[model samples]
Target chain A: AQSVAQPEDQVNVAEGNPLTVKCTYSVSGNPYLFWYVQYPNRGLQFLLKYITGDNLVKGSYGFEAEFNKSQTSFHLKKPSALVSDSALYFCAPPTNTGFQKLVFGTGTRLLVSP
Target chain B: GAGVSQTPSNKVTEKGKYVELRCDPISGHTALYWYRQSLGQGPEFLIYFQGTGAADDSGLPNDRFFAVRPEGSVSTLKIQRTERGDSAVYLCASGSGPSGANVLTFGAGSRLTVL
Candidate 1:
């Protein structure tokens, strides 16, 4: 079985401050982790993915995720949060035992206040 | 099309009605996926297709839910005896290359409302 957990239902950050949305996963073998963002009434947009190699993966909109093997975590981060950065963030791993499909977390709502 | 496209952007129907949703994957994309997203939750995988064949459908909730990609280009998801619980936004996505990379291009989902 493969699954992901996003502990926070919502995360609040001030504009210009760094923000982090936590994610953890359970997988049988090497994991492929991903981050997606969804705005209201819109489909999800791919942010970043961690396949292998470097622990830190940079993505669109000045977002990055750090994959921690020991911790089984891949937390999304941004150095300077903007109000436009506010959206729903999801953590996903390959569905089932393979990499064809994806199983997503419950998602965390990010709010960047000005 | 430019990206994955789903038809019937919004649907409202009563329980027990049959409904069909359609998806048009990106040109040259061999892999397509269907997912359902409930309010306040992330999208849940429903099915995956590698060309015209259904590579995996383990995520489908029940036998009443069926999908086909006969031509390997466009796909349709048919739901029989729709129930209130089936109401959710159905999303479609397309990707290229091997399944390992799993990079998908998504479409604005079709919102289904079952009353």
Candidate 2:
């Protein structure tokens, strides 16, 4: 079945340090990957997406994701972590079934300490 | 509106009762979708609507979960005989273009709790 996986349940980073939230997908064809963030009591907010373009894609709040086809990975990254960045991150990729439905990962919680 | 809007931010009810959640998509967005988010899990696709028709309902868990978009702008997700297991956050999102390339704007969501 086509799906996306977030290997880490939680990631911890100190303020001013770089951070990475890993995501890998298993799909039949080319995938359109997306990243969303959810703060406490808030809905998921779109961060970035990779359709067909350069491997690197940047998004809001200084967030970026690198789409690596060979590795079947699209990991979210930030150059410097902020305490405000602590939230739950999800990686979503289109499902094999025709339509716009997305298959989302379990999610990764990032904790940034000041 | 500037963003997708959902009503009844929180709802608590007894098991076996019925519930309805409403969603108002962003102006001019032709595609709307509904998803459910369980505790500690990612959002799961429930249904998708293209204009006034349901293009896909494969993600809906069962017949009891029904969604309708009559005018193609607002939608209502209705649950029949709600159960404790159905307690979750119902999310609504809207997109302007085709599925693969479209970026969805989501609402705050309606939280439902069944006792």
Candidate 3:
């Protein structure tokens, strides 16, 4: 039962404000975490990943995530929110089965108001 | 060619009918994967292919679902006796390596609606 959880169903932020979409994991050993975003009617696009190295990983579209081992969390964050950034985001961590299969979280919807 | 490509972007069919969704991975990619996404859920792993062989099919829900990667380039996911619950977007992704460290490139996905 290794899995990732997105506690929030939706997060709202005013444009130009900082925003955070939370994610937590339940897994053994050092985890490789990933974040993906899906716009309406489009497939998911990779945002960023944490494999090993700096806890702060930068991704596309000015998005970044901080991997916190103590809290077992890898939350997606942005310094300035944009209405264009609003979409569905998912937190994924690889399954322990030794395969490349990723176990994805339910997903969090981010909405930035103008 | 440019990226992971899927065919029949949308499909609507009656229950109990058979459906086939195809995927063509990026050139030179050795790993291919299939995932299903429901209305409000994240993409769920369905199968994984390493070259011409199926490295893992454990995520497939039942025997009704089957997939094949003939010649190690293209893949087709087949569903028999389709149920309404089977309606979801089937996504195909490809990676350059066999390890989880490789970032996957996903296709737009094939939306299947079982009536």
Top of the candidates by lDDT? 3
Among all candidates shown, the one with the greatest TM-score: 3
- How far out, in Å, is residue A27 in model 2? 2.1
Write model 3 residue lDDT over B1-115, tens digit each, in one string. 9999999999999999999999999999999999999998889999999999999998899999999998999999999999999999999999997887889999999999999
Q: How would you encode candidate 3's per-residue C-alpha lDDT over A1-114 as one tens digit per residue?
A: 468999999999999999999999998887888999999999999999999999999999999999999999999999999999999999998887766798886799999999
Interface RMSD of 1: 1.5
How do all the candidates rank in terms of DockQ, highest first? 3, 2, 1
* Window of ten residues with lowest summed lDDT in model 3 chain B: B95-104
Please provide, for model 1 over B20-114, each residue's C-alpha lDDT reduced to its tens digit, 9 standing for 90 to 100: 99999999999989999998778888998888898889899999999999999999999999999999999999898447667888899999999
Residue A68 of model 3: what lDDT? 94
As a whole number from 0 to 100, the lDDT of residue B65 in candidate 3 is 100
Off by over 4 Å in 1: none
Candidate 1 lDDT, tens digit per residue, A4-103?
9999999999999999999999988888888989988889899999999999999999999999999999999999999999999988888654546777
Where is the poorest 10-residue window by lDDT in model 3 chain A? A96-105
- DockQ per candidate: 0.71, 0.74, 0.79
Chain A TM-score vs. truth, each candidate: 0.95, 0.96, 0.96
| Model 2 residue A43 lDDT score | 87
- Measured over all alpha carbons after superposition, the RMSD of each candidate to the real structure, in angstroms, is 1.3, 1.1, 1.0
lDDT, model 3, position B85: 98
List iRMS (one decimal) for every candidate. 1.5, 1.3, 0.9
